[model samples]
Target chain A: MRARFWIVASLGLAAAALLGVALGPVGLSPAAVWAALAGHGDTTTVTIVQAIRLPRVALAALVGAALGMSGAAMQGTLRNGLAEPYLLGVSGGAAVGAVAAIAFHWNTVVGVPLAAFAGAAGAAALVLTIARIAGGRADVRLLLMAGVVVGAFANAAIMVAYATAPPESVRGALWWMMGSVDGAEWQRVTWLAAYVVIGGGALIVWARDLDALALGDDGAAALGVDVERASRRAYLAAALLAASTVAAAGLVGFVGLVVPHMVRAAGLRQYRTLLCGAAIVGAALVISADVVARTVRPPAELPLGAVTALLGVPFFLFQLRRLAARS
Target chain B: MTAAIEFRDARVRYAGAGGLAVAGVTFAAQSGNITAVTGPNGSGKSTLVKALLRRVPLAGGDIAIGGVTLGQMSLRDAARRAAVVPQREEPAFPMTVREYIALGRFPYASVWSTSDPGGDRAVTAAVERAGVGGFLERHTDELSGGEWQRVRIARALAQGGRLLVLDEPTTFLDVGHEMAVFELLAELARDGMGVLLITHQLNLVARFAQHVVLLHAGTIAAQGPPNAVMTGGILERVYDWPLVVARDPAVGAPMLIPLRAPSPVTVHRPMET
Candidate 1:
């Protein structure tokens, strides 16, 4: 049964990558996609597939997998079905980092993700500190509210930076603020892929800690999980994932929120299955959403983030209703 | 031989809080016996359990497990020796009973260990022991409260620890389920595991627990066998009410019957929120 699910998810991602590659301004047939991918097509077709479509498709998959895995980790640690990377203020923090880098002329490929990761770390620290002050993991509500406050504060700082920047840089910051994958290059994808593997792979390895967490902090401790240490690392990993995706593309929302629930609805309870399923389904969702974003109107692109939310909200709502009925 | 778990003047005070939650609590849970901690609402019965597990820090004093101080041991070492069953089980995501039970083997698992037959064997044994074989594949949310409690106990059992600590395990159970749970705890105790139960069910304590500790306002009011501690003098003064203590009709367990309060029991104080 598990193997079947894995095959289905992997096939879905592969099919979605092909579809995303084929549906852009210049539509290509399946044979053409394969021919171009295999370097057997005309020069224009080869460059289009190899240089343009391939990087965009790869970045979409990587971002989806990273965000999706981070979402599962967040939900598992906070023990809330609605917990997602962006909702926890990580994307906002990354935006602060990236925007600050761009505004200050420090927008090197390496410098941007580093700054975004630093911002994400700062947000996580603030959230954990607030939770501790409210008396040690007091309630999920406290953490969620703290996230909103921190996100708002980060957004304000980003705006201040944007206001002080030159007019040309303002358009660039706006594009970074509203997420897109138009600028994905091979070099950036390689670096982002490393972050995704390091963060997502570690979370998958710590699946037992997530299992222990089902019983609560005290219960988890009694189950022999190093709850404090494991939870801190999980939080950092989740932040890194969210930040990396933001650095690679922009703030692609709803993949984190939508993918995990999709995995859960398919009846996956374990973290390993959840992470793998989320990665595949998340990749499919983002690629499909991006396809719609670029192709909805010829030569005009919609923001990829808006398209994902539009594509994902109904599924999220249906799952929520089912959850409410069950409870 | 040393007791299964011993407390040496254990204390717990919430940081920056006005009062200590647990103060100078000293006791031991001997193996092969069920120990009960009973107290009023404001008392620190829960705090005592948390202190023993080191979930809450000891503001002062030390706790020893089998003659060794708890401080020197690692988290995994302590878990191998002791397991706890909480009052409620609220999993944010869905989990099958078998899957939940398998989590007990987490302490025994490492990164390189995959597809553990040993974990499966332990889970099977625990489920059978807890009499949850019928619901092994059922979702946790689908089970009744009693069934859920049993599954949780099975998970704790599967952890393979010598000491079992239960923090008000029967809070949400019905009368029959409550009695059944206590009976289960007694059976586990008889099997040579040290059982520490914190509860307000005095009648159940008298019936099942071998030893009882009465707590009042974060301090130990009394500790002895149930028969000695469940008398009218200690309970009435502790609860500030008139009460009659009588032997059970079938068994010799002590049961409390309230006569009339000198004044109506005060309502819970309102909070600022």
Candidate 2:
């Protein structure tokens, strides 16, 4: 069952990547896209596929993979089905950093992501602290409440930053915040890949700890897990993934929140399989969403984040209802 | 032999609470014996188990598992010596029964180690012993209450510890299933494993437990053989309720039958229309 899930997910991801590269403003055939990928096509086709679409698709996949795995780790460690970096205020905090960098004109490739990382780490710490203070870390309602409050604060901070920025920067930041991968570069893709690989690898290694954590703090401790340390490590890794995705793309919503549920619904419950499945499926979802975002309107492109949110919000509501009924 | 687990004047105090939850309680659970701790609500029965599991730190005094003081042992070391079945647990995410039972091997499974033949053998044995082999592939959420309880016991058994600790293990179980659990614990104890049980089932404790400790107001009100601890005088006083001790017809062990508060006899007056 696990092997079959992997095969299907991989095929879906490949198909989505191909579609992302082939269908765009210029609209190249799959054949042309294939030739361009091999560096044997016409210059225009080569430049369009290799220089523009290839990097964009790669960025989308990496960002999706990062968010997907991070979401799984967060959900597992927190033992809350609704726990995701986006919903937990980690992404919002990263956006705060990215927006601040843009407002101050410190838009260096490395500087923005680093600032975003710091902000994400800080936000994760703050949310945990708030949850701890409210009662216990095991209180799912308290944790979500803390996340929502922190997220609201981050949005307000972004608005204040926008108020002081130049019109051009504000316009660009608005599009970015809504989320797009329009000008994807190899440098950005490489950096995001590094973050995803390292952070996602750490999550996979700590998957057992995550499995134990699902049994509750006392339960995990009785099973020989250092609950506090394991949770902290998971939070850091998840924060890194969330921050890097925000730095790469803008505020792409719900990929993190939705992907793990999709994987679990497919019957992969263990953390290792669940995390890996989420990464593959997330890549496919985002790549497909990006394709639709670019193609939906001929001359104008939809925000990638907006497209995902459209699909994700309904799924989130459905999940909420299911949980309520169960409890 | 030294006790498999010992709590010497152990005390546990929750932060912001006015008093110690487990106040200077001392006891030893020996191998090949079932030691039962029973008490009313708020009498610190569960608190002692928590301290033994290292979930709560000892405010004063010491707890030792397998002759090693808790302060000197890592969580893994402690787990290697003792396994616990908590009073209640619901998996946050449902997995197959096989996967759930395999979690018991976590203490022995190294992070980098992918496979463990020994752990697998232990898990298989546990499944057989707990009689949960029939539904190994079913998800935990699909299990009935009895099945879930047995599955938890299987997980604890698979941990391969010499000392088994359970907190209210029979809660929510039907009469037959509850008796089965008690019998299983007794069987394990007879096989030279130390079993520490904290429960409200006084009658079952009397029948199966070799040593009984009755707590009241965070102190040991009585401790001795079941026959000594199960007397109506001690039980009624500790429980603060009216009850009688009767001999079990089958096992001859003491059985407690709690009585409702006595009501005054009054002549029935018909209600006027």
Candidate 3:
């Protein structure tokens, strides 16, 4: 049964990847997509399919999976359904890092991601501090409030930076803040892939610890997981993954917040399965969402972050409503 | 032979607390014995158990499982020596009873390795021993308090450890289930596993526990065999109320009952110097 779930999920992700590569501004047929993938196409066909859409799709899938898997790890450790990267101040923090790089005209390869990592680490610390003050480690309501306050502060700081930036820098910062996959290139994809592998790998490795943590911190300790060490490792890894997503493709919101919950509700209960399942489902979700963003309007590309939240918020509310009815 | 757990003048103080939660308590629980910790609502029985389990820090002195100090032992190492059945704390995820029981095998299995055959055997034996076969596939949240309590015990048993410690394991149980759990603990003790339980149910402790430690205000008020420690005077002294005590008719176990209503009177038993 578990194998079947994985196989189906992986297949869906593959299909979405193919669809993403095929559907863009240049109306490429399936044969054209295959021909481009096979390294045989007109320069125009190859340029659009290989140079533009291919890198975009890869980045989307990688970032989506990172966010989804990180979200699953966060939810499992915190034992709260609402514990997502965006809601935990992770994305807001990463955005600050990326925007700072953009606003200062630092166009180095790794500069923005390192800045994003620092911002994410800082935001995570503040959120944890707030959670601790509210009570013990991470009560759900206090965590949400902390995330919101941090996010609002980050947005305000970003506006202040924008207010003082050059016109070109402001455009770049605004575009990055709103989040887009249009700027994805091979170099960015390679850098983000390394980040995802290291960070996402940590998330997958702590699967059992995450499960034990669902029982509570002290309970996990009694179960033989070094609760403090394990939680720190998990949280930092999640922050790393979330930051990588922003570094690669700005701030793609709602994918992390919604995918893990959807996977759990679909009957994958264990963290091992949930982590892997959420990754595939998340990959598919963003790949398709990116496809819609690029093609829905002719020359004007829709913001990828807006597109995901547009699809995500209604589903999130429906699930919340169902939960309310159940209780 | 399996060794005993020894507490050498152990004390635990939560930060910002006015006094210690469990203070300078020296005691030992040997293998093949049942040790009961009993006290009033605020008497620190729970605190002592938490301290021993290494869930809380010991501000003074030391605890040793077998021969190694608790502080020196890793979390996994400690779990291999002592398995704990904590109070009924619900998991956030809706884990089924079988999956819940499988968590007991966590210490025995690697994170990368799934479907551990030895772990599966332990889980199966624990489920059978704890008698949770009926609700094996049901979600833990769907089970009654007693059913969940039994499953929690089974999970600890699946830890494959010798020392079994429980914190008010029978609080939500009915009379029959409570007795059944005690019998189970007694059976484990007879099989040469050490058993330590913190309980408020005095009558059951008298019948089942071989050694009883009466705690009050972070101190051991009394510690000995039930007959030696469970006197009416001692009960009145600790509980601050008049009480009657007698031996049971069927057995020589101590039987205690309140003899009169309090005039809202209280006892302030002086702390030992």
Candidate 4:
């Protein structure tokens, strides 16, 4: 059963990546797309596929994988289904850093993600502090509320930072904040891949600790897990992944929130399998969503973050209702 | 041989609380024996257990498992020495009984260790012993209360420690299952594992436990064999209730039955209408 799920998910991701490469404003046939990928096609077709669509699709997949695995890690460590990077203010925090960097014209690949990581870490710390102050970390509602407050604060900070920026820089930051992979370059894709691989690998390595954590703090402690240490490590890794994605593709909201659930709904329970599955499925979902975003409006492009949120909010509400009923 | 678990004037105080939750209590649970701790609400039964598991830090004194002080051992080492069935827990996500049971091997397995035949054998033995093999494929959330309780016990058993600690293990069980659990504990004790049980069921403790510790207001009121600690006078004083201690016909263990409080208002007999 597990192997079958992996096979199907891999196939879905491949199909989604194909569609993402093939279905742009200047449509290309599958045969052309294939030939372009192999460096044997007409120059325009090759440039469009290799230079334009390939990097975008790859970046989308990387961002999606990062967000998806990060979300799974967050949800497992916090033991709350609603705990997503965007919802937990981690993305908002990263946005604050990335936006500041852009406003200041410090657009280097490493510099932006680094600043974003700092911001994401800060936001995570703030949210946890707020949750602790309100009651305890065990209270999911309090954590969510803390995230909302931090996210609102991040937005205000972003606006304040934008006040003194050049009009062109502000325009770029604004579009970036709305989330678009429109200018996907090979450099950005390679950098983001390193972040996702390192951060997501750490999450997978700590998957057993996450499994114990799902049993609650005391339960995990009894199972020999250093609960506080393990949870903190997971939170940092998740924050890093979220920050990297925000740096690459702006705040693509709910791939993290939605992909883990899709994986779980397919009966994948263990964290190792769940995290991997979420990565594959998340890549497919985001790539597919990006395809729709560009195709739906033709010449005018829709924001990738907006498209994901449109699909994610309803699912979020449905999950909330189920949680309410259970409790 | 050293005691399986020993507490030397252990003390625990919650932050911001007025008094110590577990106030300098001392006891020892020996291998091949079942030691039961019984107390009323807020008398520190669960707190003592928590202190033993290091879930709560000790304010003063010491706890030693197999002669190694808690300060000297990591959580992993402690877990290998003693397995615990906590008072209450619910999995955050859905997992099958088999998957849940595998969690017991956490202390034994390392980060990169994927599969362990020994761990598998332990899990299978636990499933059989706890009688939870009937629904290995069932989700934990779908289990009945009794089944969940038993499943938790099975997980502890799979942990493969020399000592087992349980707090209120039979809370939701029916009478038969409750008896069966006590019997299982007895059987484990006979097999040379030390068992520490915290419960409100004095009668079952009388029948099963080789030693009993009675607590009152975070302090030990009495500690001895069942006949010595289960006496009418001691139980009545500690419990602060009218009760009688009688002999069990089946096993000759002391049985406690609390008496009703005297009526404050005299009831007039109903007229035959």
DockQ, all candidates in order:
0.65, 0.62, 0.62, 0.67
What's the distance in Å from true for residue A126, model 1?
3.7
Clashing pairs in 3: none
DockQ for candidate 4, please give it: 0.67
Against the reference, the lDDT scores of all candidates come to 0.83, 0.87, 0.83, 0.90
Q: Could you give candidate 1's per-residue lDDT for residues A166-198 as a string of tens digits?
A: 877743654666689896789988998888889
- What tens-digit string does per-residue lDDT give for candidate 4 at B163-212? 99999999878998898889888998999999999999999999999999
Mind giving the per-residue lDDT tens digits that candidate 1 earns over B1-273? 788888888889987888898889888889999999998886888787677667789999988877778888888778778887765557777688888888888778786463355778878888888999998889888899899888889989988888889999998799999888888898899999999999989988998988999998888899999999999999998877679999988898999887764556764533421
* Minimal lDDT window, size 10, model 2 chain B: B264-273
Instruction: Give the runs in model 4 whose Cα sits over 4 Å from its true position.
Output: A104-106, A170-177, B240-252, B259-273
Give the winner by lDDT: 1 or 4.
Answer: 4
lDDT tens readout by residue for model 3, B78-173: 887788877646787788899988988888778797556689889889999889999998998799877888898899899988888898999968
lDDT of 3 at A113: 84
Clashing pairs counted in every model:
0, 0, 0, 0
On the 0 to 100 scale, the lDDT of residue B119 in model 1 is: 79
Residue pairs clashing in model 2 are: none
